[model samples]
Target: MIDIDLHMHSTCSDGLLEPEDLVNAAGRAGLGVIALCDHDSIAGVARAMAAGRARGVEVLTGVELSVAWQNWRDVHLLGYGIDLASPELLRCLATFAERRANRNREIVAAVNRRLDHEGRQPLDPDDVTALAGGVMGRPHIARALMARAYVASMEEAFDRYLVPCDVPKTYWPMEEAIAAIRRAGGAAVLAHPTSISTDFTVLERLVGGLAAIGLDGVEVYNSMASEAEAAFLQGLTRRHRLVTTAGSDFHGIDPGDTMGKGRGGIRFSGALLPPLYARIAERQEPL
Candidate 1:
């Protein structure tokens, strides 16, 4: 059984739960260890660590950065064992948050324009931010649209409107993100390559580029992967000689779907995974 669920979010980013609440939930769920891999933000790690310590659960420090490929496809890069206090990492994350905020605004504008054209009620930017818990994103927009009955579901919202191809938006440069992770003494792992719509050749090129820029691992088991997809990723990791990582990608409050919790039904022995726990201990050793 997987006792450690490594990819979770908190109110520090897009998740619905607060840091303490997330840690407590992990403990309640019988998770021995959990990592707070918030999106582009380490703000929740300290609180999560404190909560974990109090509950006799280990908390790993992590962040999921949004990186843009050459073709404008977005990839999530998970950085583990980062020195959250490192000035370079802090600076880079600040810039990323700023860019994400700008992108959120643009997405909101697009949504509003589309709604106006359709003669429907538009979403207020403030309501969208509230839905996002301060760090606005396309997911928040999707939720707002859903709340207003503009879309049937979150997947529909993305497929029909919010995804990058459906709207004009900018993404953070990939090379710079890799450099920032390296500067922070962290390991950058490619997160869920299946989400990128590309051929095998493009995927290989993307992985190669990331590896050249100091990428350390590839997520072989993700919440979204099928058994076959997971096997393919395992093969890809071996081919690239990249460290393997796996996670549930828990987003807390599942939006009409129960897919991202409790290992995401991707069963594996926690004892067999060395890199995941080793990275956790390495980061917690200093604190």
Candidate 2:
């Protein structure tokens, strides 16, 4: 069966690989279908699509939107099969891009203030920008920290500075993000349902509410979910009649986060792709 990875990132977001390089890596991993779900930005989609063609791999137009739910700061929503030319969607994403940049800078500034006490040289914004493919985020900053010898690894960078120095991030409301995805002819899936809340009761309510409002699917198979958690999520999707997807949530900074196959040998069967495609097609229907 052909393997499919429905969620991942490129340098367009926090990922280490360039768009084409990511596609090439996916090709090497034998992923028949993959989606570049960069954080709030689809800038890499076009380039990845071109690379996909060259590699004979199917690249879906996707974006990982950060959404604000009730009392939740930044819940992730995965949008698949989005229309790249959707003006409203493009405008919405542009706002996210700007917000992310501002947040990155703010975090760097905070980190710099802390670095001042250590008597270490501060990181240049340009150095962080150099690491990003297009849209910059915290991972770029983490790389900047590593390059400056402020941290030994990405984990250390985040632990020592990135997390503590993080600034408030602005995001579209959950409803707005879901509506935008639908309007753009895409399937909006909840990424790693566990991230929203570990409590099954709370998660059920969230998923049920989102399904009522137009959530098309959930990430039932991912590096974040254990077999039991995946099974629970699968049941949740079944109850809500939502399509299910698998992804590595790969950024390529960690050695364990593989492209097609995620950590612990997670694999997605080709069966997951049909329902996802059908959901996207359903969204394309005129109201």
Candidate 1 scores a C-alpha RMSD against the true structure in Å of: 3.8
lDDT of 1: 0.74
Give the worst 10-residue stretch by lDDT in candidate 1. 255-264
Q: Which candidate's lDDT is highest?
A: 2
Q: What is the per-residue lDDT of model 1 for residues 1-287, given as tens digits with 9 covering 90 to 100? A: 55777788887787767899999987887777777888888988999999999998888778998778677556888987777798988987787788778878878887778778888887898888877764666667887888888888878888767874244444567888877775676777888787774356666777777777777788767767767667776777778767787677777556532222423464434563577546445444644
For 1-287, candidate 2 gives per-residue lDDT tens digits of 89988888999998999989999999888899999999989999999999999999999999998898888878999999999999999999998898889888888899999899889999888777777858888888888888887788999998999888989888889999999999999999999888777788888898999999999999988888778788888999999999999988999998787877744787788789889999898888888
Query: How far is 241's C-alpha from truth in model 2 (Å)?
Result: 1.2
All candidates: TM-score: 0.79, 0.96
Badly placed stretches (over 4 Å) of model 1 are: 116-121, 145-166, 197-209, 253-264, 276-287
The lDDT of each candidate is 0.74, 0.89
